[model samples]
Target: MIEENSLHPETLAITSGRPRNTPDGSINSTISLSSTFHAGGVVGYGRYGNETWTDLESAIAALEGGPTLAFSSGMAAISAVFSILPVGAVVTASNQGYSGVMTLLHTLQASGKIEVRSVDVSNSDEVLAVLPGTALLWLESPTNPTLAIADLPRLISAAKDAGCGVAVDNTFATPLGQKPLVMGADIVVHSVTKYLAGHSDVILGSVTTKDPALFSRLEDARKIGGAIPGPFEAWLALRGIRTFPIRFEKAQANALEIASRLSRHPKVDQVFYSGLASDKFHERASSFMAGFGAVLSFTLHSGVAEAEKVCESSKIITHATSLGGVESLWERRRKWSGESQLVSETLIRLSLGCENVEDLWSDIEQALGNA
Candidate 1:
């Protein structure tokens, strides 16, 4: 049985989706570096498909509970979603959305195809206020940099009522923490480059949606967008996904501990992690999450210059711009170009990894002390 032979997601990282032993008895899934996979001649070419990438695609689609389409980067996934909008259409989105998303919207507007309106994603009424004219409602729960949370079901219902498609950026929560498609999302999108890829190596994106109609439209756009991910990138994402449950478990634990320590640290002005009781979303997080996620935001007591020092002084945490990796990272979100002013200039976002909590705590404590 699959249950007996398979490891739970944690153990599966070391087992599932592997190439079975050849008669010679090998255990690992060998990387098929070929640009072409022509087993039945039906796979014919690599551009439209490949055997290994197809296998990885099927696995992730199963995990997300919907039909899927993959892309080279998270932005490509998002662009594929944006491609379906007709000229003069309207789109409703979050105030806390990823910075690059704003850039895309600017491009769409300049092309004379759409109008973009952003609102506080948690405030369902505000999102609904402009939904009547919208072609899409973009929700980013536990949004980037700020970590703000959104109620998926309510937003989806509102969008549906208005005849608009709902796309939830599920990168932060990942499927293990939240299943947006099951909850009513028209489409569930990810920067698989982050949590799903887990290792910070693959730069990929995916969109999973239950509606066959929407899937078809997005699928056509994906093939032409020429945003397809490389075969190896898909393989890497597939490999990384096996460890999600464990990676998330350890990262969540480390995040909570680090949040608690920083909340009490004298050199810290405030922490923005939803897992903390002091955050507005703590109750919602408690009700919805298996646990709080690994990303946390904190501000240095002295302000922007001191915030930069926290990044410069940290010993154990890497001061970088990306998140959801096996190694911890720290960065000033406001300074990350294109991010909204809502991200406090003094705030430094931390992405907790599988590292020992004590070491993370020491590094953070010492870095704040430098301020």
Candidate 2:
């Protein structure tokens, strides 16, 4: 057997979780596509385990450096993390992050299930102040929409010292750009619906952990909550992982170029990309991350109306929700009512894709002009 650590992640992305020396000469694992097995082995039912989900999970675990479990959606994986906490547990999370996560946290708080502490994750001191009684410290670096970077090492260390579990949403950074587990996070979650799949075609989520107890707990949560992914979707995501490295390379390159150009554009007030030296979080992000991520956000001088117009006017970039597709996508952040008020109403979030940089920029220029 090949040692996972001895191989590069790019090579692992293509080669991990594959069947070894099959007599049928098949390279890819086929979808099991059954609800029940023959009742003779460890996995008796599809919901408990499937070779397809296992293959996808194994590939992600290879990148994340841990055991992983796939969920029906990113939110499902997040919910499983919360499930680990005891009733009435105190949870601290980013004040501004993925709206779905924020919404779920607030909903739980409203139901008197968990006490919520919202803090600026970029500020270590602010985060630490509320950690004493917290059960979990949830972090999202290059945070959703606004792209604020966090000091993961400092926060994770403090959380551990305080006896709090640490969970990081690595959806934005992806496993390739950053590894929170290596930084000592207890758990890492991803909305595989985004970058890992590399196309907008599938919806999936994952939870990874180096701790066997935590992994077993989360695996039970997955099985009990019935948050398993479809066999076909898992197969599609595994197919997508084969090209994850190359796709991310092209996307990040386009992001750097587009963010630079957008920063210089007259109509743009500010660009929020950690890749740009002018960005506030650039230094922090560069200190730990392998690369600045592919997503960037910018605010328009003309406000929300113009932001909406820019999204609508784009020809090449799709005006849509969800990201990390082969084609570029952009959206007005505050259009969703649940979105954090901390995010500027005029902010337009861009998900850079593997499209030609010049073409993407031309689309942006035309959109800005029309707006």
The TM-scores of all predictions, comma-separated, are: 0.92, 0.98
Candidate 2 lDDT by residue in tens digits, 1-371: 97879888899999887767768768897887999999689999888999999999999999999999999999999999997788899999999999999999999999988999999999899999999999999999989988998999889988999999999999999988899999899999999999899889998999999999999999999899899999999999999999999999899999999999999999999999999999988889889999998999999899778889999999999999888888899999899999999999999999999989999999999999998
User: How much does candidate 1 score in TM-score?
Assistant: 0.92
Measured by C-alpha RMSD in angstroms, how accurate is candidate 1? 2.6
lDDT of each: 0.81, 0.93
User: Model 1 clash pairs?
Assistant: none
lDDT of 2: 0.93
Worst 10 residues of 2 by lDDT: 17-26
Q: Which stretches of model 2 miss by more than 4 angstroms? A: none
Which number leads on lDDT? 2
